[model samples]
Target chain A: MTAAIELNAVEKRFGNVGIIRDLNLSVAQGERHAIIGPNGAGKSTTFNLISGHIRPSSGEVRLNGDVISGLGPFEINRRGLSRSFQVTNVFSRMSVWENVRCAVLWATGHRYAFWKNVDSLPEVRERTSQILDDIHLTHRRDVPAGLLTYAEQRELEIGITIAGGANVVLLDEPTAGMSHAETDRAVALIRRLTEGKTLVIVEHDMSVVFGLADRISVLVYGHIIASGTPEEIRRDPKVKEAYLGEEAH
Target chain B: MNATTTSASNISGKSAGDSLRFYGVWLVGIATLILLPMIFSSGGSLTSFSLIGIAIVFALSYNILLGQTGLLSFGHAVHYGLGGFAACHVMNAVVSHGWPVPLPFIPLFGGLGGLAFAMIIGWVMTKRAGTVFSMISLGIAELVASSSLILRSVFGGESGISTDRTALPKMFGWTFGPQIQVYYLIAFWLVISAIAMYALTRTPLGRISNAVRDNPERVQFIGYDPHVVRYIAFCFAGFFAGVAGGLAAINFEIANAAYLGAIQSGLVLFSTFIGGVAFFFGPILGAILVTYLQLGLTSVTGVWQLYFGIIFIGIVMLSPGGIAGLIMMHRPLARAGTLQTVIPSYVVAAVPTLALACGVILTIESIARTHSGQSSPINLFGVAFTPASPMTWASAAILIVVGFFVARLSWRRVADAWDRAATIARDRGYLA
Candidate 1:
């Protein structure tokens, strides 16, 4: 079976400084993968490279064996890849319903319908409400997404990411700022929502990485030191010294 | 059970009432448009009203860029002027060849002209939005406006290209020769374009434009090229602006270099923003108010441009939402039936503020007259007073100082009343 995502010898440089260097990573289909790294390890930059937010300096980022390095972010997204930002990036001016509806509109092939009222599209509205329901934000659907609390906005952001029904999802620290209890709930939602799909999450939380990921990659200073199942990663000396450390306990 | 039924009925009742209010406003607007010429049935006022109608379309088109898409364009008049010039040429062609096209259809050709230019320039302009796009637009406007002077064959040199509306074939026996006929033609387009632009706000492209405006990156994740959305919106805005220019061409029987200038672009921006960029009708209100001020104030004073500047500044500082926002702000109060409680306070506040305005106007006008070497006595609100008199100067200073203090006190009262009323509405759950 083709891998869901593959980044081969990827190098990213911002001006004169190297950020992500010679990164090689792959995730098989129907697996939950996590990338845990120290700060400034270019975790978000790695996500950006794969998601087409920025071009890699050198190397191939592929989805399902199809090269996607030079494609625009939207074009990449259209080819069954969707991503959530590290920051809560929901449309602040739009109501939560409209936010999800926008994603659903594009996913459902209503990219440029100007004559028809979007609300009248039963499929769009139903799917939007379904995603909103899955996020447990049905009550707050009418409020502007910006007015939502931070945790709620993150939930809405996740809903928007998966609303497109993309087979591969990249979530950049989906629960970065959540409380402990909120983090548990978000992990559960992510697990349930990303069932049977490929999820590559860049998380700083060791507990989340161990508890949710089927496999994990340890990245340090723009290079992956180790990649294995969570048990193997726990035992790998390089991963333990470079990243997991005492926190693996 | 009773509560559930009542709440359900309330929801349906609210939507029903909302739609009723929506249609009612449009009905009233149409009635006002038809009855306005009748009420002010004069040659000059008709001309002014027709210009207001044209400006309404122009401002609405500008709002598509500034308000809807959050793209501040400094060269929107490029399309408007091009459309007008195109319409002039079309009119000239129709007359010279007797193409059998009626005067009413001339604006379509203008719209096509605008669309052509927009298609050519939008690819490059829509690549960058915000400040960069705005600067590029400004540069383009200057380039085209300068070119208009040099391209005398196309722009008719400095005098502009003129064509007779009467030269075109009659529309069902009406040659559109009279200003009233032209007024009707403009009003017809004003209604059509306003409705079309409003409908656009309800479409997917419109919603996505707002999305792209608020968060372009998120829009990308949703699988949309923000550039494509911005390009389509720019094209539509140009098309409508061109249509307005076509109307202007018909109204004035000329399309000139002035039509493409920064001043024309600035006027549309001022009117769109002053009316309120947030609301759809804001630009319409702004266009009419600014046009009226332009025509009415210029007749009375030479400082009309200064007044426009003052009004633009005042609206920006006080109510950035413009007139539409100001009107919408009172909506909860109107619905709560407590609007009357603030009215007396509003009047009290207005009294001293009007005095302060009068004092300032008097000072400025006198200063201007003196500068121009007019030694004549000025009429201060029907009271003739010599500008050279010490009493006049002293009284003016007193009015300024005292008016300032009194207006401040009254303004406080107005704010207090507003807060009190707003608190009541919030307590009653009438405000969200």
Candidate 2:
């Protein structure tokens, strides 16, 4: 079976400096994969390259064995890949329900429909409500996404990322500012929501990475140093020296 | 099981009530439109009402761009003007060819005209939003406005194209020669267009448009091209703008270069912004106030446009949400029954506010009249005063100095009262 997400020799350069160089990463279908790296490891850049936010300077990204490089973000999205920003990026002015519904609209095949009322669409309403419930935000459905608590907004971010029912999901530092209890809740939410789907998460938290990822990849500088199961990755000396360091022991 | 069933039934009951209130408001609006002419039977008032209706449509269409899509367009009048010209031509052709097309159908043709131009232009303009979109729209506005003067045969040069509305085939035996008949015709379109625009806001496209407005990048990741959403909104705005333009053409019996001018574009922008861009009914309120002010102020002062500029600036700085926003700000207090606390403070503030306004008006009128070298006495609040009088200047200065100081003090009290009322409202769970 083809990898769900494949970045083959993907190189990204910003002006004179190289951000990502000769990066080769493969995430298999139905696997919860984590890319753990220190600051400036080009983890977010890799997410951008794969999601088509910024084009790779060289090489190609593949989704389900099909080359998706050079496609616009929406085009890439339509091919069943969705992503969330490291920052809590959402339609801040729109209500929680609206933010989730917006993600669900295109996936449900209601493209640019001006004739039918959105509230009357049962499938959309059901799906939106289900996601809101899953994210434990049903009570805050009427509140603007911007007004939500930090952890709640992070949950909303994950809800939106998975609301489209995309097969491939990429979350960038979803629990960056979250407390321990909040991070546990978020990890549980991510695990539940991304079940049976391909997840490629870039995270800094070692506990989330070890607990949630089916497989782990440690990135150093602009290249992947190791890829294996969490046990094998914990024992990899290079990963320990370069990234894991004192935390690994 | 019992709880779920009761909740379901309650949901259905609430929606039914909501729909009832929805239709009730629309019914009341239609009734008001129908009875307005009966109440104000004079020709001048009828004419004013007709202008207000056209302006309402135009401003609402402009809001679809500015408010709904967050596309700030400077040349929206191009669509309006082109639509007017198209309708004028169609009416003339129908009259001369003896076609049986009725007058009510002309606005549809105008809408088609606007749509055609929008589809062509919007494809290019909506490629990049923000500063690029705004600049391109400005350029296009200048281009179209200049073309109106150059394209003499089509635009009718300086005089513009005129048609006889009475010559069109009759609807219900109303030839539409009388101003009242035209007023009714405009009212009908206004209601239809308003309903359609409001309905657009509830649709999937409408919801996505708001998302695009808030964050275009996020919209793209959700499998939507923000550019396409903006283009769709632009086309709709153009269509409705065309309808407004067609109505204006029929009302005036003329379509001129001025219809496509920058001033006309500015007027729509002014009305929509002042009314508030946040709500559907904002532009309507704005259009009514602007139309009334345009008519009322033109007769009273030569510097009316200057006053419009000042009012627009004031709304932008003080109340960015416009009139609708201002009114809605009091909703929580009203719902919580805490509004009474703020009312006394508001009343106290009103005295100095009125004095300050009068003082500013007096100062402006005096300066404008004197600068223009017009010897005519300026009539303000039914009191005629010589522009050259020292007493007029002194009184204006006194009012400004005193009113400014007093108004500041009173406004502080109003703010204090508002905070107390808002706190009460929050405690009552009526405020977020």
Candidate 3:
């Protein structure tokens, strides 16, 4: 079977500031993977590349057997690749429900379902409720998503990201800002949502990654210096010294 | 599944009973609109009706950009004026040269001209949003307005342009002379154009435009080019504005520089705001009120400009939602279940609005009375009137007092409606 996602010698650069270079990694089907590294390791860039927010300088990115290297984010999303942002990017002015419904809208072939009262779309409503329940945002569904507490807003952002039903989900630090309780709640939600998803996350939280990821890749200064199963990565001294000691987490 | 449909999110408080009430109001609104022409029983009234129809279409088109899309174009008249002028040119050519095309087809020529112009300007203007975008639209307007004088041969050298509407189709029994005939013709086009514009808002392009307006970066992330969204909206707005301008040309039997001039641009802006920007049909209501005010106030008081200015400023400051915004405030209150308690406040609000209206009327009449035109004293409906009269001052004082109370009452209603509406929206799951 084709890898769920493939990056073959991928290279990305922003005017000589190389974000990713000669990076090669494959996310196998149903694998929960983590890319852990120091600052500027291009953890987010890799997410951008796979989600098609940015084009690779030279390399191929394949999602399940089809190349979607230079496709726009929505197109890539349509092909089952959805990603959340580092910054909480929920629609501030619209209700949390409207924010979730927009995700349901782009997918599910409801593009021109005007005249059907937007509130009454069964599929949209159903999916939006599921997203809300999964993220524990049911109580705040009516509130403008922007007015939510930071942790609640962060959950809604993740809820929106996966609301599109993308098979492959790129999560760029879902627990960037949170209390211990909030972080644990987020980890639980992520694990539940990623059960059937091919996942890649950039996280500084080691316990969360070790507890969740099937595999982990160590990226250091735009290069993937280590890639293996969690057990193999844990035992590899070079990997531990280059990543854990130099900028240990 | 709608958060709003859920018990937690049902902000409309609209259960089956409320839905029935909502639909009742909606049906009544539609029924009244259809029945309106009956009230104006005479054919002559159709003339006034059509003027409002054209204003409605024009202001509605203007609102799509300014209100919905959050754009402010100072030179929006470039299309209105240009469309009218182009239609006039088409009329001049088609009639004098005997092009043999039907008369209704004339508006298409105007629409196409406006579309082409908008396509070019929209490309440049849509590159940015908000202040930068507004500046570009205004610049384009200034550029075109200034050129109308230089391009004397075509623009008619500041005298503007004119055409003969009667020169069109005599194939049918209609000679097109009666204002009533043109009024009906315009009414048909107005309805068609308004429907088209409203439908446009419900389309994918429309959704994308709103999305782009709210969060262009998000739209880009979603793979839509924001510029493309802007271009489509621009071209569509131009098309309707063009049609409206064409009707304006046919209405007056003339089209000129003034149609595309700075003042015409200002007139559209004022009218759109007066109508309220939120609802699709609000501008239509706005145009009717504003045009009537301009005409009625001008006849009664010489300083109609002052009246227009005061109303314009007041609406902008006091009623940013326009009339529709005010009307829409009802749903939130009904949801809150406290609209009954606000009834007294409504009465208080109406008092002040009436008072202000009279204050404005007197203030303008006072100014106009003292102007040095030195014309003969005019007969006021029952009494002869001149400047600097004790009687006029006394009458003005009474009007001002009445206006003060009326305005006070009006504001009370406004505040009560707004406050209760807020509470209601919150109760119904719409707010934080």
Model 2 chain B scores worst on lDDT over the 10 consecutive residues at: B1-10
Q: Write the per-residue lDDT of candidate 2 for residues A99-213, one digit (tens) a residue.
A: 8999999999999999998778999989999999999999887777777899999999999999999999999999999999999999999999998999999998988898899
Which candidate achieves the best DockQ against the true structure?
Answer: 2
CA lDDT scores, all candidates in order: 0.88, 0.90, 0.75
Model 3 DockQ, alpha carbons vs. true complex = 0.21
CA-based DockQ, model 2: 0.55
Judged by DockQ cut-offs, is candidate 1 incorrect, acceptable, medium or high?
Answer: acceptable
Each model's Cα RMSD: 3.9, 3.8, 5.5
Q: Scored by Cα lDDT, where does model 2 land? A: 0.90
Q: For candidate 3, write residues A122-164 as lDDT tens digits.
A: 7767887898899998877768666789999889888878887
TM-score of chain B of 3: 0.83
lDDT (Cα) of model 1: 0.88
Query: Can you rank all candidates by DockQ, best first?
Result: 2, 1, 3
Candidate that beats the other on DockQ, 1 or 3, i.e. the better one? 1
lDDT of 1 by residue, B1-432 (tens): 011110011211147778898899999999899999999999999999999999999999999999888899999999999999999999999999989899999988888888899999999999979899999999999999999999999999999999999988998788799999999999988888888988887777888888888888889988999999999999999999999999999999999999989999999999999998877888999999999998888876666788788888998898887888788788778878888999999999998998888777778777776787776776767887666467667777878999999999999999999999888877776555
Predicted model with the maximum TM-score: 2
For every prediction, compared with the true complex, DockQ reads: 0.46, 0.55, 0.21
Write one digit per residue (lDDT tens) for candidate 2, span B330-356. Answer: 877999999999999999999998889
